[model samples]
Target: MPSEHESFNTRMAKAMNDRDFQAYEALLTDDYVGEYPQSGEVIHGPKNARAIIEYYPGTLPRDTLDLKSARVGATEARWVRTPTFTVVRAEGTGNVGFSAMQSRYPDGSTWWVINFYELRGGRLARSTTYFAPLFEAPEWRKPYVEQRGPTADR
Candidate 1:
């Protein structure tokens, strides 16, 4: 069983992954703040969650969320009509962008976004994130990369 605090963080993460702006907004504290140090972008409160959705643009295809766990239960379909809800997500942060090749970043592809969160009052007080599209190590870098240790034959 998870504590309420852990549950809150999980809900916030899920809302972000699902592109469920409404659910995400509910998880933010009144003073919630999000920052991208690489990009020097700051967004405050629940209103800013929209920016995330706009930039990602359904970037996360499959959603594995338990909406019932959220602090504010907003149905996916109804939230669309709410004015605050925007199809916004973060754009390329600093030097990073979504993807040049649509084929490479297909609907269900994995683009990793790592978030470091600080919780306050059982809600998201602040969070910092970095995102990058997943890719195979290039042939050129393989030489510089460390090789795995040899293992006994299975």
Candidate 2:
């Protein structure tokens, strides 16, 4: 059987993939913080967190996101996976992009995000995301970058 932490992380990932902000909000702590990497800006509280999700449509290509693996510690969980984003340009051009992200779940209730994405455009066009931690003083954790697969895995 999966642990409670693992189950929570799975549900969170599913909520993101489904774009169910309501469900996502339910999983968040009362005071949630959302971090955006491109601007290195942090959105504090659930209100800001909801705003970030609402405005997400304008930021990147929207597609079904898949959550691969999740690892949990005493009070934190890290999800490692690549999401396929279908990028759409204002000019009606569209393409698929893949980016790796590590989402930390504090208290198994809220999720703090740290993600890096590169669009077809230059570095300035890239996007970064950060979110609030569940604990009083959240520790600094590293982001998950994609690694080359072994021949057998490929």
Q: Tell me how far candidate 1 lies from the true structure as C-alpha RMSD in angstroms.
A: 12.0
Runs in model 1 with CA error above 4 Å?
3-6, 17-19, 54-109, 140-154
Per-residue lDDT of 1-154 in model 2, one digit per residue for the tens?
7533334445555666555667766766565555565567866655566556545522222343233333222213443232212211111112222233333322233333444322232111233454443343223432444434432221
What's the TM for model 2? 0.39
Question: Residues 1-154, candidate 1, lDDT per residue (tens digit)?
Answer: 6545444545654565455777777777888888888789988877766666635432322344343332122356432111111112222332222211111122334444556666665556777876555566566887788745322110
Q: After superposition, how far is residue 135 of candidate 1 from its true place, in Å?
A: 2.2
Each prediction's TM-score against the native? 0.51, 0.39
What is the lDDT of every predicted structure here?
0.50, 0.41
- Model 2 ranges off by over 4 Å: 35-38, 58-154
